[model samples]
Target: MTITLLGVVGSPSPGGRSFAAARALLDGAAAAGATADVLELADRPDPEAIQRAIEDADGIVFATPTYRARSSSLVKGVLENTGRGVAGDTRAPLLGKATAIVHTGATAHHFLAVDDLRDVLGGFFAAQVLSPGLYFEGADYVDADGIPTLTDRARELAEAHGRAFAEFTAAVRAAPAVRALRPLL
Candidate 1:
């Protein structure tokens, strides 16, 4: 079956590390026979549209830049506006769907930002968040026309993660039990 993976980029900048990583992941997912696309919060997309995309997607990749040792305000704001409750009847649309969290930072000191996002997406929303979420440091970038972009290694890693996530999501979606689990909420 064809699965759809959506990348939600929370970077305020149009084409930063987070965006590049997300694009690479989506590219990998597409190569793996899944449909993929990225939506940017920097464009000020409508909340309802974002929610709809989340609900329609089989899996989601949340990409954000670390700010103040945590996810960007854009990411938090989207979560806050999207849904509420913790695995309750009114749980977020992400419940039971596969998810991966990707964050970029100036250094590795803020890696725990992934944990914070994981707690909310997995613990709160009850999504099947992929483990060992990705983190990109400044050193992982390379100079591209005087602008920083993801190094080949970082892009490869992100793409591999995306392929695995897409395959896992497809398997989860194919199982009747997994699909039923959502309605049990």
Candidate 2:
């Protein structure tokens, strides 16, 4: 069975490297036999829209670009919104869904952003998170040809994450307890 994935792009810049990273993961997921959709949060700042989208997916991949050593405010807002009650369903939809992260930053100085995200997600999301979130230095996305693509390292990581998430989501779907309940976004 195919699982639905929602990839939230948090770059806030049109067609930037962070956008490319999210696309690469979707490609990897597609190759792994899963269907995917990308939510370009940069284009839409509405947290309600983001929360609503997450409700329909089986897993989530958060893609962000580090700004001043942290996730952009837009991504932070979206993450915060996920914790709120929706549609008389007081439960956070993200509670049961698998989540992973991929991020890009200009320098090693910003590398801490990846772990910071992991900690934040882990604090609220816990083992639902995949281990060792993927990280790419911003320069890695650039090419002499000017068309951006994932680095070999990134491609490897994306494939692993894609495949694992597929399995993780399937297990979530098979749990007897939630069979009668709405999906955890």
Candidate 3:
């Protein structure tokens, strides 16, 4: 079975750092024999369609740019639309699905925002989120034709994370029986 990885980017700009990172991650996933695509929230995509895409994907990468030591509002909005709060609804589409959280910030101070996302995906959605989520700061980028771009090291790391995410997602999909082990709440 072919694995499909979906990247949900929360950047407001199309070709900014967040988008570039997502593309690089997808590139690595493709190299690993998995198909990948990105869903940019800036385009004001339909919530229902986003949920459907999430359901179809084998794994997901939630990429965002940290704003004031937190995830962008765009990311928050999409997650809210895709899955309701655990106490309110049982719509946990991310259940048992592997996920990777990626974030870029003006400084390293906001790296913990990635952890916040990880908690929501794992604690609320029951997603198998990957550890040591990728974080890149403004300094990690260089001027490429007067545009911010990821350094070679950052790009390589994102690609490696993508490869790992693909392998992990494939493993999770293969072990459907493991879903039975989840809590019955």
Q: Report every candidate's CA lDDT.
A: 0.85, 0.74, 0.84
| Residue-wise C-alpha lDDT for candidate 2, range 106-143, written one tens digit per residue | 76677778888877765654326676777788656656
Q: Which one wins by lDDT: 1 or 2?
A: 1
User: In order, what is each prediction's RMSD in angstroms?
Assistant: 2.5, 3.9, 2.1
**1-185 in candidate 1: lDDT tens per residue?**
68999999999987888998888888888889999889999999999899999999999999999998889999999888766443444646786788899999999999999999998886666677888999999999998996667888998998898888888888877776654443223
Q: Ranking by lDDT, best first?
A: 1, 3, 2
Q: Which residue pairs come into collision in candidate 2?
A: 93-185
lDDT of 1: 0.85
Best by TM-score: 3
User: Which residue pairs collide in model 1, if any?
Assistant: none
lDDT of 3 at 47: 89
Q: Which model, 2 or 3, shows the larger lDDT?
A: 3
Q: Indicate the worst ten consecutive residues by lDDT in candidate 3.
A: 176-185
Quote each prediction's TM-score.
Answer: 0.90, 0.82, 0.91
Ranked by TM-score, the better of candidates 2 and 3 is 3
List the lowest-lDDT window of 10 residues for candidate 2: 176-185
Q: State model 2's lDDT.
A: 0.74
